[model samples]
Target: MTQLSLRNQLVTVFGGSGFIGRYVVQKLAQQGARVRVAIRRPEEGLFLKPMGAVGQIDIVQANIRMPMSVQAAVKGADIVINCVGILHEGGAQKFAAVQARGAEVIALCAKEAGVKKMVHLSAIGADAASGSRYAQSKAAGEAGVRRHMPQATIIRPSVVFGPEDDFFNRFAALAAFAPALPLVDGGHTKLQPVYAGDVGAAVVQAALDDAAAGQTYELGGPKVYSMKEIMQLTLDTIHKKRLLVPVPGFALKPLAFALELQPLFAPPITRDQIELLKADNVVTEGAKGLKDLGVSQPTPVEGVIETYLYRYRRGGGKFEPRFS
Candidate 1:
């Protein structure tokens, strides 16, 4: 597909300061697109300014739950992207509120503003019939986008790993102090981990490629692995030898509930997250994917995890033996 030029185009990105959103913003900035990062706190997203030339990237305060804020952000923008999503609900940031309703608001506002193009970030496991609320909400968000803007592009990724990702980083952190890592449901759940950078590239391509409009792409790596294998890989990368204990999903619910009750910013695991683990989180067979969007070879977990997981290694990964 021929890539559309984004030079000098005003693009509004909701949640531009987030893990996956940052990558999208950076790529847009590189393409010379003027980025307006619509975040709840403009000060928190000020760090994104360095990704582009002076005045190339700007931040505006906007909340997805607030229609007026979303409307103000998309005004006069050539394109819009919604990257706002929550892993676990917290207070008013419920899954239905942020993922479902928040998405509807963005799409509605972008359509009202006469935005030509839009790209929405979703997950591969999104299903309306799924037992997990997170997955259900994701499906609802996709439906909302389609309902509001029929031409918008949607990209669904599975287990995105990056330098600041919570997946590998969270498990590695647990291995640092804990004696063992719990493998929910015997760790048999399958997953195809995709790199955040690759997903970001897909998002950019979906935004610029006219062929991608009104299409949904499932993004994943070249290989698939079970939950047990993922945990073992984490241990290998970080040079840790923690036990991999197989635990039933039901057994973990009590502990997950306890974690949910805590006041910590991000709990180790929540009950809702355990429900998410009940099913495999891999791309469906014959689904449109990264390769369809020009990312023929998605980066594997082994290629990127070590870049950041090294910090979790003993001695800060400075004393590794070199055998050549």
Candidate 2:
């Protein structure tokens, strides 16, 4: 996509203000696409205006949960990308409404509006029969997308990590005060964490390339690390040596329940999250991944963690590395 010419295309990005969504918008802008960032809060995404030339990017209000909103957003789109999956369910944003049903709305509206192509952001664990409702809903969403737009590109990325990511950053913040971090079910569950930027590039590729149509790409990083390994890496990066308690999966239910009862914005953990960690979150064998899409050799966790995690160090970014 060098020369990255997409100036003639109009890309409507749902949830474009989110972590992965923002990166997608930036990459599309790089490709010279006229981007319409569809978000719940259009004003909040005002900062993205500078990502492209004047009048090249616009913000629109849209909620995937509402069919009319989704219809309005994709009315004249050349490409539509749905990066709107949720990890937790609370209040009015249930898994069924937002993930499963909402996905169907997007696909239906896109089809009716005659969009050229679409890309849906799903996770590696999406399964309809899975114990985790979050994963099950995601599977439903994929089914809906396939039903409406068979050629739509679906991307199932393993754990995604970057500066503003929720995984390592959340644990790093926890380590700032907590004496110890829990290793649910002995931390054997594995995760191959891919970089957010890489995923963004993949979405952009799906948008511009007709060959990417009717594809499902499972994206992961170069190495896969177990939950404990990830926790250890987090501790090391932040110059902390907190104890990693080997708590059985069953024991965390009570704690997760209590944590879930906390204010939604400040939740420490949720029961559904515990269920998700029960299984490994890695790319499945024989599946098409980043390499298949020509996004070769994705960035490793070690290569980028130190760049943003230094803020969690005892004395901050310039502080000397501490060894335990």
Candidate 3:
């Protein structure tokens, strides 16, 4: 057993209602921290209460776009974590507004409130000079945090997957029903899919480790898999076979932009999301990861897919026979 630490600390987690946020909140609660989940809608975060002991968790409304609310959330907290990011944009929720400006809000408020520590979650492909608005906003968000909280630990994780993840399971479900699955750029884009639980554990480790201050960690799984390989693995795990149709970047990219226009109804794709796939979403060379965060080796995609993807299988659960 590891030495118990960070007992009784107050932590404010922005966007704690999200897929990754729930896991991180639970891990923090297990360490005896008083976790305050800050979300735009507190009711949605009510599910987090069961993860902790009585009075160990609370939920409050704190929209990053509203600096005053963010300030109120950070006030009197020992640690603050920013998980507010958007995969696709909508009204008042563009990549720049939420990812870039909102990140700055949390950092600045935390600094003003004298919060002892902070952690920012960013994607793996963050680059200031990148063409994708998503990547650029992430890079900008990191810069904003550093500007205010120079010692904040920034974590850039590759594609995160788990029971609630929309990555592998969503694609697997689609593959189960669709006649053919499109392989963007011949599905050559490399990725290192990390488990959401592992990433959450990394957050707990970083928030408590003073030595991790001001450092950046790039997290990935034990093995790297290409887009096509991941898709195939998804199919194999769900016991479905489908044709892999290669879609050239030139032809498929324009459609991606058209998908971006979907935010008007539902953001099927954003210009930034399309641009993000042009490059591999994996860890950089020699970057600190799970090992540095003191998390055990993350579960590989192969080991985890069946646990959740079973629901999407044709017969129902993994135990259900195909012909039955």
Using lDDT as the measure, which candidate wins? 1
Q: Sort by TM-score, best first: what order?
A: 1, 2, 3
Off by over 4 Å in 3: 1-4, 262-270, 317-324
Model 2 TM-score, all chains together: 0.95
Please list all clashing residue pairs in model 2, or write none if there are none: none
lDDT of 3 at 76: 96
lDDT of 2 by residue, 1-324 (tens): 322357768999998888898889888888789999988889999988888899988999998877888899999998899999777877788998888999989999999999868999999999998889999999999999999999999999999998878888899999999999999989999999999988998888877667778889899999999999999999999899899999987888998888777774756667888889988899989998887666887989998889889899988765342210
The alpha-carbon lDDT assigned to residue 270 of candidate 3 equals: 44
Name the top TM-score candidate. 1
Question: At residue 80, what lDDT does model 1 achieve?
Answer: 97
Stronger candidate by lDDT (1 vs 3): 1
Task: Return the lDDT, model 2, position 243.
Answer: 95
C-alpha RMSD in Å of predicted model 1 compared with the true structure:
3.3
Model 2, position 139: C-alpha lDDT score: 97
What lDDT does the true structure give each of the candidates? 0.91, 0.88, 0.86
Instruction: Give, for candidate 2, the lowest lDDT window spanning 10 residues.
Output: 315-324
The C-alpha local distance difference test score for the whole of candidate 1 amounts to: 0.91
Q: What is the lDDT of residue 282 in candidate 1?
A: 91
Question: What local lDDT does model 3 show for residue 316?
Answer: 79
